[model samples]
Target chain A: MKIVIVEYGMGNIRSIVSTLQYLGVQDVVLSSDFEILNSADKIILPGVGSFGKAITQIRHRNIDNYLNEIVLENKKPILGICLGMQLLGNSSTEDGNNKGLGYINGYVVKFDNSLVKVPHVGFNQVKVNNKLKLYNGFNDIPTDFYFTHSFRMKSDVEINQCYCNYQEDFVASFERDNIAGVQFHPELSQTNGLKLLKNFIDKF
Target chain B: MLRKRIIFSLIYSDGYFMQSRNFRLQKVGNLNWLEKNYRFQSIAFALDELIVLNASKTEKNITEFAKTVSDLVNDVFIPIAAGGGIRTLEDAELLFNSGADKIVLNSLLFQDPNMVMKIIENYGSQSVVASVDCKLNLGSYEIFINNGTKKLDYDIQKYLIYLEELGVGEIYLNSIDRDGTGFGYDFDLIKIVEDITKLPLIIAGGAGNENHLAKGLQINKVSAVATANLFNFIGNSIPNARDYLLDNGLNLSNRVFDTLDLI
Candidate 1:
């Protein structure tokens, strides 16, 4: 059960390693090596360009203090998608105010063009906030995936599990326990985004 | 509560799949016949992001056919809107990390109207969608760009009131002389952008039948209505247009077109 995605150079890493080898997930590892992303068990990261060049390439490969000491002082299980879920929050206004990976509290704003339309891309519908397990077997409230961002996560955080509405209501999936975040693109989401990447690889 | 939205548009060229109203050109299969039959029957679907416009290929084969249709519709559950030739903000962040949930921007909003406030400051104006390929000219209905080829003197109701002060959640007004010519929509230019913007408007080209999507949903200020040759050359689908809009009584949005059989 070794996962480790976090490539750095900024997104589309061979389509998230061909969507984790089309969900068969043969011990996936793209690595930017922070000791193999702190000896992985499961830590996916997947980002896609600018947010100050992916937080200056994760503080120029200090790997953001070994991903805040393996997902906030050794909790383990991590998954961040879409600019790696806006760099796991706590700071980001986009081109000016930086600092994120605060491990999830909230701070990424920039897509409220008054009502909607700004990198919100396509295929959206998600509501699930019922105590997440990476939406185990999906569907609790809205559940239609695949999203492109422009900065979200505001709705007064607190690990928002899911919430999507285009011109307003933001945060579309966020967890704190083992650190999870999904603004959408569960490896380009297809069969419930490959059953949410095989339920984050059957929770490792 | 208001959630019913279905759209299915796949008109690519050169790299394949382009047969909407006899343009003829099909190849790219395994669309899994749209997920083994319209993936829970369309509440929202679209991929007509215009095959990299004016095609002829190469931007590395249109980013390898947009990453093979974003990895074959990344487990499609519903809502999918990808629009043609998106301009920048890194081509909408590589089609939102290649799985797109919504990104329809037309000719880069008339070639950079501040790239729609820089894609609502990087993906937020409801994931940015503002496509207007209108026509009418003299009597006043302008806003055309690229695909409809040039024309913009502005005033398509003052550029949808400047795309409703640049926060545009959704507006896909299309109608280029009744696109593909089925001749239905343009309900007076969708009642002039639904009498000046409330937002959520998706009226593409001329619809054809189903009473022109039941007169654009009996003008309750159209929230969604799209037709590419009335469901790809009159096959109809989306449960036959939601059973002809609930047998003409109207009032849709019952999530995913409300469990269909329509026969």
Candidate 2:
């Protein structure tokens, strides 16, 4: 199966490609080409950086339209990581109020500086919800995944969501059928991350 | 339950990994020698993060170091932070493109605050890590930059508060006095600086064994502890240290889902 990592001039695309290949999925491409993105079996939206700037870059390449046509309309499986996951929501307050792709029913807000650390770096425990395809083959409820972000998402909508606590509980991973998003870098989460990538490929 | 991290830092200088002690550099080996000796790919699974710093004192070339960073992280499945002399946005971008999950900046925090702000504006503050090389002089804590060659005339605690306001994601506080000494970390300095910043603190430089790491983690303020002494942390030593930490009931990740489990 081919996995195309949507590369619209963002962070850690090379690492994502390398990690996919390490999982024995060699036919991976990093590009914004519509044909290549649409033709793939699975697509990954991986990013690290400011939300406003990332949307600006995505819009510059018209990737927003492509993702709409391909992921929203076509029902192709997509996984958004970190900032990419935040971008899948409605909007983010980081770098000022900016709109996201609106694929998921959520919005990003910065962590309360008075409560916990701003950028909650390092490994944190994630409580998986209902054995979704993104976390299949795992029975453990709360597992460690590497998280690095200042802004976070909170939603009251019902969905397959994984919860993690820092200063307070926040969404770790949310699955809406073929579309899923995780606020942690599964690529950097060691075996737990690799297992997660494999589940997305083989099960999702 | 957020887990504390054990990070291994590899010091690089001119295409070679160096063993540093008190800011003194000694070339230990090239990439092949590192692979043959430490088996870093297998070793990477045992730790939470890997940090590769290009401590090149002579004519620092970021492009070359980024390529090395890419090479080292190809199949190594962990969060890798690469930096040393990142002075520009392009330099930070190059390292990120080369597989660095985060960029480490030392001198840039003191030299060009505008450039640092620009990076934070473009890449988000979480992508940039402020690395502080600190030392104790005349019973006062001082911050050093430019690979420990130049000392900034500011208190270490105050510098961290400044860094926090700049919106850096994490603070990599390395004690120059304890680096590679196998003695231990400067817990006193850590106590003073830890109270100042709300960002995640990664304490480095001077961990001789698992006991030192445990002691560092036992503190309520420290988020992670790191070691750069190659002799003390190469090969199975990392995995052993991790197992020891886990066996002792310290809060580290369990490797039940590791790649080896797939094999």
- Backbone N/Cα/C clashes per model: 42, 0
lDDT of 2 by residue, B11-116 (tens): 9999999999999999899999999998888888898998999999998999999999999788587889999989899999899888888889999998898999
Per-model DockQ against the true two-chain complex:
0.03, 0.74
The local lDDT score (0 to 100) that residue B150 gets in candidate 1 is 76
**Chain B TM-score of candidate number 1:** 0.30
lDDT string for model 1 (B135-243, tens) is: 8867878777766657878787788888868776778787877775677887888888888876767787767766776777667756567776524433335556666
Candidate 1 CAPRI level = incorrect
Clashing pairs in model 2? Answer: none
Q: In model 2, where do residues sit more than 4 Å from their true spots?
A: none
lDDT for A33 (candidate 2) = 96
Error of 1 at A132 (Å): 22
Compose the digit string of candidate 1's lDDT tens values, residues A1-204: 678888777666555665566556677787877788778888888776567778887888888888888878887888888778778887887778898877888778877756553545555777764356777745466766667666777747456457787756778778767888888776544455656666777753
Q: Score residue B240 of candidate 1 by CA lDDT.
A: 66
- Top candidate by DockQ: 2
Docking class of 2: medium
